[model samples]
Target: MRKEVPLLITILTAFIVILAFFLTPLAQTQQILLRWYAIIGGFAMFVGVWNLLKKHVFQVSRGKNTFYSLVLVLGFFMTFAFGIYSIVKYKDAFYINSPFMFNFNYVLAPLQSTMFSLLAFFMASAAFRAFRIRRLEAALLLFAASIVMLGRVPAGYALWHKLPLIAEWIMKIPSMAVQRGIGIGITLGAVGMSLRIILGIERPYLR
Candidate 1:
């Protein structure tokens, strides 16, 4: 009964959302449903936080990567504490120079940026293998990638006068055209998936 109820609700909601586009009167109904969706999503965030804390605390108790797990649990509590303090002290208006803001901007923000900066090196290594000139297509891709990568820098301009112009033309024309084609493909796939879900053929959430 529980599964059947959810499946029926899913089909009804999907149909209503689809109908809202052609039937103007259903648009307000769609907006109300969307707001309910937002409310449910807010609650879902707490569920996720609970799950994360449970997993990390379990790891800490089991002594599996205890240091990292303990750090995660401690960090979560410290962040939550400062965040609540900031909210109460500032009356829902967090200032730029607040303790929570300082921790986020200086500590967490730099850590995140450094992590992403390290990832760029790994990406470059992977790109080098993918951009190998083993075939005509690969060679062309390598050339295009080289031009695009270089043209954004001042050194590329110093190297050749027309290199940046060629790069700009390639990006604005061929790259944009390819992106539009991919977007259309993605839109079609999304429509197909939506139809499958509405028809009860793709019951992924049930699993």
Candidate 2:
């Protein structure tokens, strides 16, 4: 009964959302449903956090990589504590230079930037291997990538007068067209997936 109820709600909600596009009354109902969805989503985030904490706490209790697990748990609590303090101390309008903001700027931002900076080396290595002129397409891709990379720098202008102009043309024309084409393809794929879900062919929610 529990599973069936959720499946029924999923199917019903999907149909209503679809109908909302064509029906005025349903559209108004859809707006209300959207607000409810937002509320549910906000609550779900807390549930997710609880689950994460429980999993990490279990790992620590089991003495499996206790240090890492403990760090994770501690980080989560510290962040949460700072967040609550910021909100309370500022009355929902946290100051830009608050303790929480400082932690985010000095700690979180650097960690995220450092992670991406480390990936740059791996990306360059991969690109070097992939950009090898093993075929016509590979050669073209390599040429385009090199031009784009050089165009982004002042050194490229110093090296050659027309290189940056050629790079700009390639980016505004071929790159933009390819990006738009991929976007359209993704939109079509999403629509098809939605239709399949509405028609019950894809019962992921039921699972």
Candidate 3:
């Protein structure tokens, strides 16, 4: 009975949601359902927060990487507290002007940027290692890659005037064709999946 009841509710909810999207007269009903979804999602966040705190606290208590765990907990609590304080105390100012934004801009932003900047260096190193003029295909691939990279950069245009033109042709023709083909394939696959779900053939929610 428990299983059957939940299955019935799920089917009914899916039917109502589909109807809400297609049937224009049920706009008010759709709004009500959306409000219910929002309320449920808000309550679910409390569960998420509890789970996160429990995991970090357990790690710290076990003394396994306790220092990092403590840092994680401190960061989480500090952000939460600052958010609450900003909302409750300074109702007029934007949250971006709060302590959260200050920490994010001065500390987190620079750290994140630095981490991602390392990826460019890694890519250059990997390209240098992988690129070899041993075979015709490998030589062609390396040449094309180098041309594309050079065409995009200022130094490439300064060194050779024809590079930008060749790069533009490659990007506009071959690259666009490949992109369109992939997009069409993805669209068809999504349509097939949606049809399967709508026809009750794909029952991922069922255990």
CA RMSD per model (angstroms): 2.1, 2.7, 3.4
Cα lDDT tens digits, model 2, 169-200, are 99999999999999999999999998887767
Model 1 weakest 10-residue run by lDDT: 90-99
> Highest TM-score among the candidates is held by which one?
1
For model 1 the local lDDT of residue 96 reads 82
Report lDDT (Cα) of residue 128, candidate 3. Answer: 76
State in Å the error of residue 115, model 3. 3.4
lDDT, candidates in the order shown: 0.91, 0.88, 0.82
Predicted model with the maximum lDDT: 1
lDDT of 3 by residue, 1-207 (tens): 755665666666767777878998876777888899899999999999999889989999999889998998999988778767777777722467877667778878999999999999999888876685477877877888889999999999999999999999888998899899999999999978766666656768765
Question: If both were scored by TM-score, which would come out higher, candidate 2 or candidate 3?
Answer: 2
Q: Distance (Å) between predicted and true CA of 94, model 2?
A: 2.2
Worst 10 residues of 2 by lDDT: 90-99
Residue-wise lDDT of candidate 1 within 1-207, one digit each (tens)? Answer: 878899999999999999999999999999999999999999999999999999999999999999999999999998888888888888553678677897899889999999989988999998888887598888889899899878888999999978899899989999999999999999999999999999988999995
Candidate 1 TM-score versus the reference? 0.88
Q: Candidate 1 — which residues are off by over 4 angstroms?
A: none
Compute each candidate's TM-score over C-alphas: 0.88, 0.82, 0.77
